[model samples]
Target: MAVKGLNRPVIPFMAYLLAAILLAMTPAICLIPLVDSVEVWQGLEANTRDLRAQTESGILLSMGLVDTGLKLFDNTLNHEMEEAFGPVVAEYERAEGNPGAMDLSRVREELDGRMEIYIINESGVIEYTTYLPELGYDFREIPYFYDRITEIRLGGFFSADRVVAGIPTGEFRKYAYLPSPDHRYLLELGLAPSEFHESRMALKYGDAVRELVNLNPEILKIRIFDCLGTRIVGEECPDDDRRLSLVRQAYRERTTLEVENATARELTRYLFVDLSDNDYASDMSMVVELTYTTKAAEEKVAGMFARQGGVLLFGFALIGCLCAVAMHSLIRPVRNFVEDVDLIASGDLDHPVRVGGSEELVHLGESVSAMVGSLKETIQRVRASEEAIIRHSHTLEEQVRERTADLEESNRMTTLLLDIMRHDISNANNVANLYADLLATEIEEEAEAELLRRAKAGLAKSIEIARDVNTIQHIEGGLPSPGPVDLDRIIRAEIERSPGARITYTGRPVEVLADDLLSEVFTNLIGNAVKFGGPEVGITIRVEELGEEVVVSVEDDGPGIPDAVKPRLFERLSRGTYKESGTGLGLYICRMLITRYGGEIRVEDRPEGGTAIRFSLRRAGTGGEP
Candidate 1:
């Protein structure tokens, strides 16, 4: 008993140490994510600030280039005009902002359509132009464009904007403005794209976009949209009405706008860039669409996660290693003590048990070692007692065999009594039924006669119960083996037993693997349906050949079994319903017999509102039915 108790395991303390370690590390581990979050937030803020400055600086630099390039470009145009019609433009100066004093028709013939020159009066109206379309166009209706020209009419230096599409026509053109010497009218030259424009690459927006994108890693894309809401530089995407509206808003407000698009994982920045002057840069003004990514901050957070995980892994491994080294001193002695005790318990009394470590461990080893000597003597006495017990057990075995024989005799007697009781029950119910038949014949009144008939029916039901009891009692015992049996013959015979029943069967010649008792299965099922469904009930006996097995379902238009009772219908003493007659052992016996023939039976609900007892038996032969 003591040895067994020593071998029995006690509740373990494995989790305590691990819990302590986790508790100790809780603060540090919890701090990791918080620190990571702060770092990410800081990184994003710093990145946004740096890129904001960079973006504004780049815009300012581009504006400066556009401002300077206008002067050089305008001077070239003015030089060309002077060469073409130096005397003509000097002749037209006396028009006094009227532009009708000179022969402009002769100047237009000299120019030959290389460029179109516009004479804008101080009131910002185009009074004369080489192009006939602007013979006397008024720019005053357009408050923004008129304001830009007024500023140019007022400013000293000549300025031009980058090539842009027309506001309404969408035609590409570049215009530079200069003050005609007397400032009476502003001389404006509109230049279409030609070989001369290729030399003026200083104001190309495409170059600026490409440069910014190439220099900044966070800049995924850059697009410049002109005042007409057309993407002039960078890649072109499909027109987004929302985005175009936002661009128009930026142009109106002349302020920067930012939209963080989570689905695209980028921040869209709209920088309303003003060229030359805020009000005067109407055609030159544009919105810079900057798409920025924060890949650096995301990578920083991911890197921190990986590094922290590695550090935690290393810390855990170090703890494990230190624990293993420390446990060796205590574990070795305990392990040796357990092993030696186990060995002694397994009949190896001579096995040594020595533990050297702490004073308590030494004392335990000494005490156990002394116990082992006493155990050795005790084991000898136990061995002697065991030998005597073996001899006594042999005698007990003989007595057990005699008791077993008596038990078998008792079982046989019980079975005999069951047979006698079944016979007596059958005989007694048959006599009662005979008396009921006689009483039924003597009754003249119809109601009294009906009562006698019901009494006989009940007596017959009792007789069925007696036979069912006999059949069910020995269901678990041996039965006849399966053999070739006429399926139709058996079904037809069972059908004949109930002549008046509404049984439907398309008889066909078939053979199945079952003994003569297969008829009992049909009997119990058919009788059950008739007893419950009454005379008008319809019954269907169906047989289907499926591969090596033949399935048969005996269904009736009786009150269908409840779904809850279907599972246990074939179990011993499981009646269909309390109101039905006969013992519940009929279906149970059928199941046992079907099982003996290597078939299975089950209770099911027929689709046509009835209960069905379905069973399967193997085909008689390997080939088609004989």
Candidate 2:
């Protein structure tokens, strides 16, 4: 049956789909039994059980042989120790009443083969020993001394593995101890692991304990523990808490224990065995634990799974090919429709979609072509509107340029007219002063000559006013290029040029960011000070450095500037005092020039007497313009 919206003739599509489904199911049917069948699971379990049994048997047999060998060595050593010291101990007990009569040193020499003797006196001091350095040592404080004495007092030698120090060399000796002579002294003797198999009686068993450890490759570790849970011999034992728990369980129960927890990586089995038989302590036991890792079992299981995994991989490959073929048939018609729709959306409407496999796709292609035809008509209208807008914007840009040019031309003419007026007025004032000087030479009356001189001075002042106005125009029009200027050099030059004023400059060499006009700032301030401060004006110029700028001050010792006048000292056409014949533009020009250089100028009353005119300028970079 055909699905909804798939309104095409679908008999062929349905047949292809049925063939693909059957092809995919064929491999799955064959491989399912190979993976999850009852026979396969049973085989894996059977192999694991067999391997575990073999590992257990080998480990148990080795441990049993080792236990038997160590027991034999313990009994032989105890018997030999008793035979050598049995009689001497009896004689020493009989001579206890006369302690001084027994020769302990001679007794030590006689029993000094394969053993060392210490003859501790009644006072618990080692009075004589085969090892001379131990002779004067006090034995009362040592635990082993008292433990051995207690054992011997009950009429038996104390025997165990212990560490003891030897003669003058003071080297360690691992050994067994034999206490005798009525607990007055004790003898220690031991055999190394290699020496245990040297005797003919021990050779029959043939180093079984050491040999068993070497034979097994699966055994990761084997350890032997004494009754006290102290390790006696074996490989270095594992420090895992679970392994320690197993060893402790065996020691306490005096029985065999086998533990295998889920989290444990190795199987551990602890077997407690008696190491003493006949004339040896019955409570003495040794714990032998064997540890075998899961390496062999894991390797077997990994190989089985690897083989089965190969079959499953082939099954998946066959399924993937069938699905690829079936999906291509279902998706090719839909994919072609989508591609055509994307092309039209991305602005390509000329190519029409021609997909014709099914009825639904044919109808979709016809709808796309109709929509593309409508989109083409709308784009033509948009293009025509954009062209008209671009033309209007170009016309506006030309009109703005023309208006800007007219404004620039008008500004130039105004500047030129001011320059001509200043020059002509200055020439007229200079000619009038020359005529006044000529008239002064001919006239005889004193009053007439004085009047003429006053008129001449007025004309000179007017000329000066014209020159100041021209300078102000130049400053307002545009500022000059600024560079480093030496402050100390400028101050000294201006002081020498001022003939009337006695100026004293005291400052270190400093540079400021200002152009050649910087000298004019100092010259005007000094000249104004000389004129305003009577004939004998005393001026002191000081230059001080601020963080990123320098301040220059001109202090005059004369009548100080008034509070009202100080505020307007740098204002245009303003004067400190109206008594002097001078243009008021000097301080104003100074303020303008300082400000143009991103600096400031102001006047304040001097602390000593007169006025201090200070101006600030940026400190210039060293060596040049920066």
Candidate 3:
């Protein structure tokens, strides 16, 4: 059987399988790069820490070597002075008794190699010495040698300077005077500055030590100060400007001035080591100044980081390439499935996709194939059913039309009869009531008066029925057109017309696009409230204007309609569970009239009490009320 226009072909199974595969591959591809970048960052961080540690270690080791070498040089100089001076003083003492065998020149030459040797006599006189021409005058005129000879009574030593080899130079030379057994003559040995320079030259790794450890070799300046922070040697010796500045700073602050300029750049990391002997060793109190360039250390660290980054990049690239190949292989099936689905969606479901690897995809293809077969069968079945239903529907519609025509004819006949009877009977009942009064007065018999009373009662019932019939006719004819009307006036008039009903207006004056029809609407709503509600029931008319619509609510404090009947309240001939006397067309007519004017009407249970009938009328625009 051929299906109707609604028939649709089923999608192929392979297409669905491809879609799922592609969706799964997307995240996998994204994670590949993310994971690789994280690994690279981790490696770089580790390399940075290692490089910092290595740089710090190298700096500490270099400083240690410099300090050790300085210590050795100081010790050797001190020992050499003590050894060479001891013998010279002994010879001077022994010769004091025999002036003929004194031989000062020979004594000086013998001690020359033993120390930075020079000779001074018992009177603090430079009598003979190596480099003799450089001592322009006798040592007796020199205060340092004289002071040492007088102060060191038992041949103790003092450091001083003098001419050596005809050139004036500074040295850590020791002067000692030994008294003869007769206590008449003294001898002295002075170490020249040349001896200290020679000792520095003889040290192992001397050149490398000077090159690496010299803080500022190009503008090299060295100053040594005593424990009291007073300069003892170097250029501008004993009172060099740099040394004095350091001494003054220490004196004012009362602390050691140890500054290390560890980099050539203006930025330098300096440690001010405290020289307080009260809590530490005397050797530790000696503050060493070191200066070096940070450029080298910075370069080394940068190189290490760069190398690490390069290695990481290379490794990640390799991994990424391998992953890409694997990802392509895994995702190709998904791509093919997607293309197949696209073709199916574009209305070409005839082509079947070629099945590939993976059990999941194969199962999906099978499912899709089964679904397509089922869909094709369903389409054929649906088509046949549709044709049969169409034929049956046409027959049913014809029958319904015939029945509706008959029903309308019957309704018209009934309405005509009811109208004629209501008019004729109402008139006859009025005439009968008038004649009964006359007859009752004229006859004046008890039996006749009772009969007249019965007749009058029947007349009243007939009149009531006539009124109900008239009301139904007026409503069924369609409500009158509306113009601008005061909603308050209409509500008040309805309340007055139905006096027995309790009516309350809780809103201000609200003008609406309505006329007599508004009055009719209110009349019907108010009448219903009074007729169906208890004596105590109150009717409230609420009016409000929303942006482009005016709403009016007529709420009644009455027993609400049952839930089952509420949905059908606006339907023709629908009645509530409560058997109130009504044609059941009042709400239906109300809905029709309101809808014709672009308004809505609804009935709902009141929040606190009975039932509320709400209707909204659209505000006037350039066109008539909508």
User: TM-score for each prediction?
Assistant: 0.43, 0.39, 0.31
All models, RMSD in angstroms: 15.3, 18.7, 28.6
| Model 2 lDDT, residue 321, Cα | 79
On residues 251-312, what C-alpha lDDT tens digit does candidate 2 reach at each position?
77877898764566676778776544433322345677767666666666676667777877
Better of 1 and 2 by TM-score: 1
> What TM-score does model 3 achieve against the real structure?
0.31
What digit string (tens of lDDT, one per residue) describes model 3 on residues 318-384?
A: 6667667766866666676667657656756564754454556555656655666677678789999
State the lDDT of candidate 1 residue by residue for 1-626, as single tens digits.
12213333332345445555754675466567558766766877787778767866876577557656754664565445445435445656665545767666666566666556778887777777666666666777668778777777677666654454545446556666776666677777666657355666556766755665677777887887877678777776675688788888898888989998776678878888876355234556788887788666567766767777677677667767766676774477578778878987897777777554444555576677779889888988999999999999999999999999999999999889988999898889988888887777678998888888778768877887787776766564556567799999999998888898999999698888777778889888888887888888999999999889889989888888887778888888787654764677888889888888778887788776988888988898865334
What is residue 404's positional error in candidate 1, in angstroms? 0.5
Taken over the whole model, the C-alpha lDDT of each candidate is 0.73, 0.66, 0.58
- Model 2 poorest 10 in a row by lDDT: 161-170
Off by over 4 Å in 3: 1-332, 338-349, 437-441, 481-626
| 331: Cα error in model 1, Å | 7.3
Arrange candidates by lDDT, highest first: which order? 1, 2, 3
| Model 3 global lDDT (CA atoms, 0 to 1) | 0.58
**Model 3 steric clash pairs:** 122-186, 131-165, 134-166, 482-515, 483-514
